[model samples]
Target: MILENNDFKLDVTSEIGRLRVLLIHSPDSGLGKVVPSKAQDWLFEDIVHLDTMRTGEYDYYVKLLMYFLDPDKIKGKLADIDNPESKRAFFKPDNETFHNSGKVVEIQTLLSDILQQKDIRKKLVAAVCAIEGCTYRLQLQLIDIEPVELAKIFISGSLNDEQMIFAPIPNMIFSRDIGIAINNHMLLNKPAKKARARETLLVKYIFFNHPLFEGYRDNILEIPDTVQHFLRPGEEQEGKTTLEGGDVMMVSPQHLLIGCSERTSVSGANEAIKLLFANNVVEKVTVVKIPHKRDYMHIDTVFTQVKRNVWVLLRSLTIAEPAQDESEPIAWFADKKNKDRPEIVQFRRGKKPKTFGTLEALLDNISQKDLQSTEPTRFIYSGNDEFPFDAREQWTDSCNLLALKEGVVLGYDRNDKTVGAFQKSGFEIIKVQDLLQKFETGELNPQEMTDTLILMPSAELSRARGGFHCMSMPLMRDKVH
Candidate 1:
């Protein structure tokens, strides 16, 4: 059973259960602004062409999702304000000054609403005015002029003659990292990077003002307003905590796993775990410690549950043993070339002391009741134990799969070895094109499908260093039997 929220039921207890609702953001104009020199700073491996992303594989991916999900549930980040209802709700034009009631009026209306809130209005004004180029006079003048016209000045970010108040958030398409949906409650996350801070703000604005989430304010997780905005990749600075949705996984109603990786810190996980335990929402919390590298930025980058009792994993992380008894309990990397025993290194705190015990000890505390049978907990390695194939495929997120239901999964077709591994595990592999054709010809039924892998084209999407699991943020799922 899925408990209904105000509009949709925000219930997700297991990863491989049937997906009922999802939140997806297609690539926007902001993506085109990212340049090669600043790609790494923006957390992108390489700059992707806006045209390719918009019209290529990603377009089909969103279309395929729409075929099964209700159209209303597949919300777009850029709301069309041209509609009469939207215009009325978002803007009220002033005939005396600005007559163009389309983009300018809509933005002004939102700004006006912000200015009306006495509690936050002054703070916002002070914050923007405190900047070097943003003068109080300029902000005051902005109230009258249309904001959409000044959008290029903000996006270009050259503050020479203009106030560089905003920058393009190119990574907003990976909506999974903006917020996390646990059980029936939603936690709007504070991003660990400055580049993504605005994405969190957009999500907050939606949940606070959007009609879909109107009555569920209490259900949304709350954090202090004074919290730090950004933390260095692996820096353990005090007084700040950061968490991302990509590092969170709901194993069951009672057991939740949070990975302290490059993008999520232990301090952040501790704060969340305390609240979860206090509310009696999660009985046990396992904090998995992973390598702090771009390749393994999040746990889902190397591990995901693809079907009932089945997990796709990078063997290097899960099965590898530490090099010595004195080293850390978890061995993250393996030498694919040698194809020998696991290699490990001793664990050391980055810059701050850990308030909690060793990760090994924390994970050992997982209740025995949640452990699965030996036969059922089988893992399919990314490349089926092959050499260079395993190393190359793992780098491209071969393990990151999104499950629509038990025994039905979605993956990238470029990873042939990984796809073969799934086929060897009794899953019938079918390309997205073939699957759609079957649906159109009345030969395939998604509801009755079992042990199937629906492969999606990934030539361009893989460049973003994410897969289906990273792109979607599921709000509701039918409970598994």
Candidate 2:
């Protein structure tokens, strides 16, 4: 996994062989904490029933991954392990404070009670991540702290409550958003906010220590320091760096598309690109600036690549407007007297401007652009279009599809408008329910459905702000033609 500058070529010409060996964390009791009161702040738009959501998600993983590789071939962190010795060895608390201060005992007891596990190590790990106790602890910690107070201190939320409560990570099941594996190395994402910090920790532990990934090298990246250095004076408020994997689309080994959105900033993207390029981890990183609206949280929410030279994207956001170059210059005084040490870095400032066009026009432009040049260009749409607003709305997620192989993909069954567009584009749609039935009956073989599109019912998934591709991360893909 040693990345030489020449080895990092990013080209998204096809979905083929672009990404292989994805890592995912299934939703556990951690999802139970998403309520109306806590949902929005945690980036969830709706509260979902844990049971139903899990059931739907299981179908998604089974059908989708099975289509590309053997169910046994794909790896999961939550999969069962038979060795108790191994579990204890991996999860045992290593922190001196946690072990010596009785916090380990407290955690073990709480986890055992909630997870019904007899093992102390397993219980403590799961308990710290469980929804019931985790939230109770966090809430109790924040009870009297003003938003202002909480803002000033990092990790300010409490851990002192006796009663354990956990927060729901409804988004965890969609493992692709948390981390990505490029070639032989794994990059665990550092999300923008604290609510998802646990995701980063979970990914770090799994990639570094998971038995399944023991032979692989880990290449994790964090932007806090770079953000601080690049934005200096604005680091505390405006230039806080945050980038999620969802906004990144690998066009090829040599090219990548990065979405500059609410969760990821222009400065953050610039900083990340500089690191990737300077380190030779990527040949070219194209920053596709997206909106900051809550509904459109990450770029993947609006755009996703489905096959070579073809893409399924939200017509509006993806092609709506050209991301304005809003970068602002920041001054840094490096050793005040050492005239050679003065440094200045520019940070993008202001919200992105709005687009004025129809969805089709935007897609048309993207298709026409010469994306290979070092200089960046964008495609946008004009407002007037024939489709209804609902059709356009569905296009946002309506067409956001995830591919297991070339033409084979997974999407929401309820997005008829978007589904219609796919069919029109020559995709074979297999209803998610049908696929699940076939799987249960042993009639469907994932490896056999190599180049087909499998659509999952979005009745539950759509409410949570993701689609088929959003829910699953592709670990490996056959080489593109």
Candidate 3:
């Protein structure tokens, strides 16, 4: 775990620290597989045109990342870094010559392992060959092809008319939900939805076998694969064990925040809490139970840290009349009332849920003390004292902002109210294009900026219901001051 100046480090201790490295997946042809008939089943709210997302939505996101970090430091799908020059730039240099790097060789060897394993190879080929339009003989012959090409086929996605043999992971663009980095270690999560299961598998392969991650060990939260859920009885109910990176966050080195939402189950949060405590990684854990509805699928969907002590949250979660919702608790901490069998407070559907006072309980759990100063941690609601605006903006992921550094964040430009709220707090709201232009012209430097919020294009990305935080998975970040 010793970090050399040139060696890549995998650690993230805060949300708003200066970003050092990132992992992302740009949109691919798999998005085209999402037909209107089954868009919901595929985890997509609506069918999106692959070309539009690739050229407009995804391309702009990649450009923004390249601006903050060296292109070589950003990791993504093999298709995006297919060329020799890109490969050389992306992989670690072997010697004086960059072309001799270990990336291709290591990845190929990893693919070779898949080909070498009889059961795995058969399972993979059988799945692909099963596609309605695929010829079993022709597809089976693909095994004889080179390892690199085979890997490409696997990643690029294979499909036929009726159904996708290997559905291109369109959702991979949201890397934040696939894997999470804690301190110097990696936590590989098992995605709840079948559509995103392939994403977890792909990311796991890269981290476990790729040369760049060869020396690292990952603590994986394993669950049933997509196929297993349907094939095995009671497997569908086991989804309670699912955990996603979107529902997990690092509040500080000593504290961890896990959300039990539509995407992350209470069982999953419990498992993560157990693991974090067992590893002594964190001293305390907070399990926030958000509404199970899709609009509030993940905690980040309705809440995000904007600065060191400031948070942007949905107004619906926190109340104006502070009597405490004793009927609907939105957050939970370890119940001290139960010592023999410690449990989180009762809240959620099916069973009658109870609510707790938001301000007092949240402050107590977060600060672990009675605080006199309220300005220490400010909470900004998504919309102004407006009803429809709050519901409307929250649907577009207005609260899901990603902090580049303390006081500087990134979010969707379309959320005028949310952006205005940050601006009202003395944040300099700058458009992504404006900043990109400045970076290109050498007119602005991110290292010197403070209290800024860079707005990104959201015409298409917002349609996907994600913002900067959902799009990014920080591999490393400078410790916040």
lDDT of 1 by residue, 239-320 (tens): 3578888888886777777888888877787778767766666666667777777767888887788654677877666444
> Over 4 Å off in model 2, which ranges?
1-20, 71-163, 227-236, 318-396, 436-451
lDDT of 3 by residue, 240-293 (tens): 578898888876666567778888887787677667766666666667776677
Worst 10 residues of 3 by lDDT: 334-343
Model 2: lDDT to the true structure: 0.48
* TM-score, one value per model: 0.73, 0.64, 0.76
Candidate maximizing TM-score: 3
Reference-based lDDT, each prediction: 0.63, 0.48, 0.63
In angstroms, the error of model 3 at 435 is: 1.1
| TM-score sort, best first | 3, 1, 2
Better candidate by lDDT, 1 or 3 = 3
